[model samples]
Target: MSETNGAWTWRLEDTSGTVVPVSEEYADQHFASQGDAESWVGEFWRELAEQGVVAVTLFELDRQVYGPMRLDTN
Candidate 1:
């Protein structure tokens, strides 16, 4: 994963070993960088946790943003 200009626009393999984008909108918003978006995502998750959301999964694809990406119970 690589970032440019404090924006996150990289692909990472999830636990499933699938490579995907952190977020498409973020990529576009940040000019295909991979820092700012990641930071935001971290915060987003944190907020969800604070809201009592138990499980969350974030998914992506090569330049494709696909999720929260999934949520699980138990």
Candidate 2:
């Protein structure tokens, strides 16, 4: 898993910790509120499953802005 800019990328790993092919768009669309995006993710997952992939586990990494803020009153 890796994060760059404001995008996050995640990959599915096997029990032995091996990287497997998982669609980033799928993950995004899986959580997306858009109907088209959700459909796309569904297709992606279907394709992956057709390739004899079963019982895959997802690992995720997220990045966000965090800082301290201070206010001054005049």
Candidate 3:
């Protein structure tokens, strides 16, 4: 998918590829840039893991750019 001009967002999910429901505070995070989206996840991935988010998928608008990236830093 094209990586430019579209909104960047994350699809939080568990290992089963099921979407995980995070708290409202993090439920609506959308970014104008991919770096921002990556950075946000980098910062909060620990917390997300604690809350059962085992993986994440990146999307640009409705098009998935990449992922199902595991949050495990091991």
Candidate 4:
């Protein structure tokens, strides 16, 4: 999903490769650019871990930019 025209989305995911439900708590997961998405994950991954997000992924349309990056160290 597009955050805005010419922008990207920071999608939160579960271990099953399903998109996590978007909530008021995570309203900003979609970002203005890839860098912004990465930055959001970088800053809040620990919080995401607590919320049961095992991995994260990025996309522009059906194209995956990157991810499935793990939040848990173990």
**TM-scores for every predicted model:** 0.27, 0.30, 0.88, 0.75
lDDT of each: 0.39, 0.35, 0.86, 0.72
Clashes of each: 14, 0, 0, 0
User: Runs in model 3 with CA error above 4 Å?
Assistant: 1-6
Q: Compose the digit string of candidate 1's lDDT tens values, residues 1-74.
A: 23334333323334454543444433333324334455655655544434344333332324354443432333
Which candidate tops TM-score? Answer: 3
lDDT digits (tens) for residues 40-62 of candidate 2: 43445556544333433322234
- How far residue 63's Cα lies from its native spot in candidate 4, in Å, is 1.6
Candidate 4 clash pair list: none
Q: What is the lDDT of residue 65 in candidate 1?
A: 49
How much is 30 displaced in model 1, in angstroms? 6.5
Answer with 2 or 3, whichever has the higher lDDT: 3
- Model 4: per-residue Cα lDDT at residue 60: 70
Candidates ranked by lDDT = 3, 4, 1, 2
Stronger candidate by TM-score (1 vs 3):
3
